[model samples]
Target chain A: MNFPSKLIEDAVNEISRLPGIGKKTALRLALHLLKQKESVSESLSQAILKMRTEVKYCAVCHNISDAEICGICASNKRDRSIICVVEEIPDVLAIENTAQYNGLYHVLGGVISPMHGVGPDELKIASLMKRIEEADAGVKEVILALPATMEGDTTSFYVTRLLSARGVKVSTIARGIPIGGELEYTDEVTLGRSILTRVNYSAE
Target chain B: MNFPSKLIEDAVNEISRLPGIGKKTALRLALHLLKQKESVSESLSQAILKMRTEVKYCAVCHNISDAEICGICASNKRDRSIICVVEEIPDVLAIENTAQYNGLYHVLGGVISPMHGVGPDELKIASLMKRIEEADAGVKEVILALPATMEGDTTSFYVTRLLSARGVKVSTIARGIPIGGELEYTDEVTLGRSILTRVNYSAE
Candidate 1:
């Protein structure tokens, strides 16, 4: 496919590598970027470069943050006694969008998947346990808001066992979500129900 | 909605400005960009920044080109006398993808749209007429592959009148495409038929 320029082609290739974007859509996106005002593209480039440079995981919650601790972790009004365990920073955002859960969050960064070679150690599980044990507020409940995937279940099981031995109440979201659909695609109502009807997990 | 970082927010906003993208999709795209290798993002950034510098409109054909003339206009073997006029560079790429049309092309840049305040002066109509009048190859047929929209029809009518006055045979693509549908989305077979069965428009 003879592109107008090598630069256009390179941008398209990079964009196509993204989730859900194809080559044609990537080309369209690249063209759209090119047609935009110089400042718009410049800001976008600068943003990506800056994100790569300055963004880091919160030492407390493991969520992407610009500071040592995320805004959620720093907030004194939030329920310090409760911690919501989620897969990624986006999941934390999803929960926060509801303005429903006032509890703090512990972003696992990823789920435990033997197939993908991601184990419990690969995630921020140890930090979560340490947060529960040594927490100044003495955490009472740990809510599992991970996706209802096989890997998600595995990670949840591992966390529940670790937390139960330490005598912390560990629970998971209800089975209201569809079997295979991702948590990101689920509507707020269903997600809210899944969170509201959460059940305790018996450590094995 | 309270993004973790200003940089991430900027990237999301920039991606959301594209044709069909929304805020949610933009965030996903931005996150995807963040996950990519540094070199990939750098290449994408440089490509976007270098668009105007690397690509220029062909001086003769108005098609996007790296050199003074596009590949079609520069090619010695192509039928220089038969100029197929289209609305944009994407149309040129669509036609070339078929490997059927061996004729040179003239890109109008856009069609006449009085509602949107676009007119002949805004398009490359004058240059097209100049190309025909300054015919080094003794040009014969001028194919109008402009869209089948109202504005496209008006542009085709305007071009046909100007060409017919100079004793040139002007033709338009057949009416198989649905109204308001773009030529870019049309199937190759349907587009090919439209090209093959083009009708002569003798200005009354």
Candidate 2:
């Protein structure tokens, strides 16, 4: 309402559309951008643009990447025998920051939230199963690092049942992470501890 | 170390550069962008790019605009005779949000801060003085709407001395605003009250 400029107003509005960024915070961020040198703002804008234009989902692991395979999937140092499954790319970053895990990762895109209309058909579960069954026989484990939500638990159970049918070692990352704690907020020490304490999941 | 893609890493790193956005939060925002439809991220990115590319400062009032003069300076409905000086464009927005003030504004760009090496020359003080001294004779009241910080007080005193010597009615928004409070953070009611009870400067 009667903002300083149309461009600024539009910019603030667009930023406010971002999750967790309100109008007041958007205004503060926009003003901060306006105050910086033109090059800084220009670079920031370009980086955001590049993220949309260049990044894509790694076809193999469903992780975000600029190519067919994500860096984690491409890395020779990581143990291909173990694949840590998570709900999103940020979960990959959370695990990576720990500097303790030397295993590969697979992003599930999302958990099975029937309430949100998300089912196995919409997820990358089929591809995950195929990858595990088809990988060279060195594959030893498939770790479910999904959030400890009900939906995450349901998805993990279904995956374990399916993967176990193929005789692959199935495990869920430890429940040491708080029941409601988001992977994005957990610190490296706690996350590493949880990873180290992974538990086995067997079909009842 | 082994971030998925250069573009994704660059975007996350750029976002992390913002105040209070840590590496984890940056990664979270980047992942959110990746999750959105391509068009949504592209549009938001383009909006930021356009803001940096097309937005410019109003030569007359120092507020950001797409043209040479800001809307407040060009609007015939606004009282150009009364110039309300503020530290930033957000301050102008704060005042305008009330819809009670009819006066135009002058943005100082920043207040005087010795610790930050910001002084009179760093701000738009000279341009403001030129507008007052050489503009139409209708120009009368010059209200200082600066923050209540030590730097804000110093800047106000400095600007008041400069304008007072030129035989103009120089005033400052009252001290009702809590000390050390920023204009951007104050409520409209408090700011309006401060404006209504502005104190006139006199020779000691």
TM-score leader:
1
lDDT of 1 at A126: 92
Using Cα atoms, each model's DockQ against the true complex is: 0.50, 0.54
* lDDT at residue A24 of model 2 (Cα atoms): 90
How do all models score by TM-score? 0.84, 0.82
B24-46: candidate 1 lDDT, tens digit per residue: 99888777766767776776667
lDDT of 2 at A188: 83
True contacts kept of 2: 0.70
Model 1 in CAPRI terms: which quality?
A: medium
Per-prediction backbone clash count: 0, 0
TM-score of chain A of 1: 0.82
- Please report, as a residue range, the 10-residue window in candidate 1 chain A with the lowest summed lDDT: A2-11
Best by DockQ: 2
Question: How would the docking of model 2 be graded?
Answer: medium
Question: Per-residue lDDT for A28-147 in model 1, tens only?
Answer: 777676666777777777766677666777899978787888777888889899999999878987888878899999989899998988988899999898888889869999999988
